[model samples]
Target: MTQDYGFALARERGIALGPIGHRIVEENELTRVWEVRLAPGEELGFHIHYHPYYVVSLGGGDNEIETIFGKTIATQEPLGHTVYIDEKRAIHKLTNRSDQTYLSRLIEFKAVRWTYDDDPAQARPEAGEQTPEGYAAAFREILEHTADLPWEPKSLKGLYQKMLWRDEETGASIALIKFDKGVGIPNAHAHASNQFMYCLSGKYRYIPTGTTLVAGSFYCNPVGSVHGPTIADEATIFLEIYDGPHYPVQPPWYTDPKDAT
Candidate 1:
């Protein structure tokens, strides 16, 4: 697909570089480009994202990153000095191991529901506008103001800037999610949109399908594919990218039957 409005804006306003620097390579309907930088002794610990990402180090020293599941999975410095991991399809962390700063570039594609999979009768052109509870409600307005939260609780899951980015205004949404140690979301459900999942840290036992995923693995669930109750030990995070405005499936538990259905 041609790079259009989304890609252009990513280049114009997306984080290209920082104490670590960054730049957007391209942004289109399916993918976006990004550049990253890290200062000496800097470490970007374990985090998550929804879209699968391809990354390459542009310059600098090595960094450290670790994922804590039942065990700790650490990345040696400069592992992707030239190679990039499809993060949307996998989960891991980035850190600067060397005394000097490091730099990396990535072009990631947000997951989207395919045209053929959705039920034609129910898939209205404006379906995205209808909010699904499990998806969007999880972070409502929280994404914009959230800063680095303490890790002690271990029960909480959150997203970081390097992994997932969301812009409600432009119809772009990405989720690098974490299933905190021993925690799982509610029962299985499907969304109106297609979804992509990647393992960044730890392991997961997804209910219904019984799929176990580790770091570097990716999973795609077509729209309406019922799967969830994601459970993990040690915080597990992953990226999910999709077309906007994603609505969540109203669970049966809602007080109002109308809301549930």
Candidate 2:
């Protein structure tokens, strides 16, 4: 399915073929998820990534990349290997050289130095009339190895997080959350903005809705909508995202705003 990931603004800026995927499967204020599939001997033509992007390889195979600068690089990654690329304004073409097809999901972080910042209409639409978070003086960057990122404690018991990226100015963030078995939010609550989640392993459930998320599941909770009283049915790890402030006011669970992050 063809979808716009700030493509309209890219075109307005004289960029014509900047898309990095065969199809964009999902997009919103926080991220654009692209599904890339390259059959043996096939190629994805020269494309540019305008924002920081991470890729999770599913069907890994022999692949080669040729940059606009004429550099050719060969690569092979095992299935489930993940990498984050903080390219310095790069452009390249990729080809699958192996007999087997290559498949992967590439997620472009829309909140990180987004291409449409000058136009508020194209920025986080859900941010709406609320104040956008302010930019911090410095934010950590993980160039290519996301597996090496360290996990930090959360104010909530039995929960931990690894912050992948964040837009300090917009309160937009992407994080990997791990919930220990038998632990979760103690009560129903709401978020200040939209929340997006993708389960990577194990299981969890929202008690009120009887909605459960397991490996490969995706969930979204819109702004101001109350839900939760959640529990981790098993030790769970999931990707969590937010498009704006986490809460209208700091929740009682967290005494330190730093821990809340």
Candidate 3:
């Protein structure tokens, strides 16, 4: 947590493994995060990255990862579900396991060379409120927003994102997102920080599990979880937030489908 750019044992292995659609969204000298999207029926050919990743399912669709022997590995669904993949010899490919089409979004968190703990201490209960006091504000708003319109993911139509608030001084970010009905974001990829999201609209069929993440649900995608391209019956809206300045750029690796193995 010192925030220094000193080298660590992790730096010895440069670049990462993954397919073409994979790309970085945020990066700095110290840490970096990549965002990858996969459409329904699309596959992120087998690859690997030398970092821990947190996969955040934005909307509809199932996420499936398989090993070289065609054995099942990791799977996930939206409504805030997450999965972790280490950047060691974790070789696998991602696909939308659902019959429905959707967009999958992933944020990969890569730390700098040095290791440090940033763990937050456990919270104690407060006396009065039914729910935690800090979360009460969001809980109350959820009731107000549920009855609102156009909630579902579509290929086209409705607003995509709305920034709710931000604390530049503290590096805290928050926003509201609406995915069109019957559509998804994209495939599994990596990024640099822990991500949190909550659903506040129509239900979305989660990837990998084919479950539904509707209003009043929240999820967290830690460090590195190669998540999915989500999907939904109609437009679904949710809150998207993350801790960033994720990680720095990495050297390119091979991504050809034929040569991925």
Candidate 2: residue 213 Cα off by (Å)? 0.3
Model 2 per-residue lDDT at 156? 85
Q: Give the TM-score of candidate 1.
A: 0.37
- Candidate 1 — which residues are off by over 4 angstroms? 1-163, 169-171, 248-261
Write model 1 residue lDDT over 164-239, tens digit each, in one string: 4554443445655655577765677776554556677778888767888888876655447678876785667776
Positional deviation of 171 in candidate 1, in angstroms? 4.6
Q: Evaluate all candidate structures by whole-model CA lDDT and list the values in order.
A: 0.50, 0.74, 0.52
lDDT of 2 by residue, 57-131 (tens): 767678999765567899884455567787544456898988898987788866566434433443553544764
> If both were scored by lDDT, which would come out higher, candidate 2 or candidate 3?
2
**Alpha-carbon shift of residue 223 in model 1 (angstroms):** 1.5
**Which candidate leads the pack in TM-score?**
2
How far residue 95's Cα lies from its native spot in candidate 3, in Å, is 1.3
Whose lDDT is greatest here? 2
In angstroms, give how far residue 103 of model 2 lies from its true place.
28
What TM-score fits each model?
A: 0.37, 0.50, 0.38
Clashes per model (N, Cα, C within 3 A) = 35, 1, 58
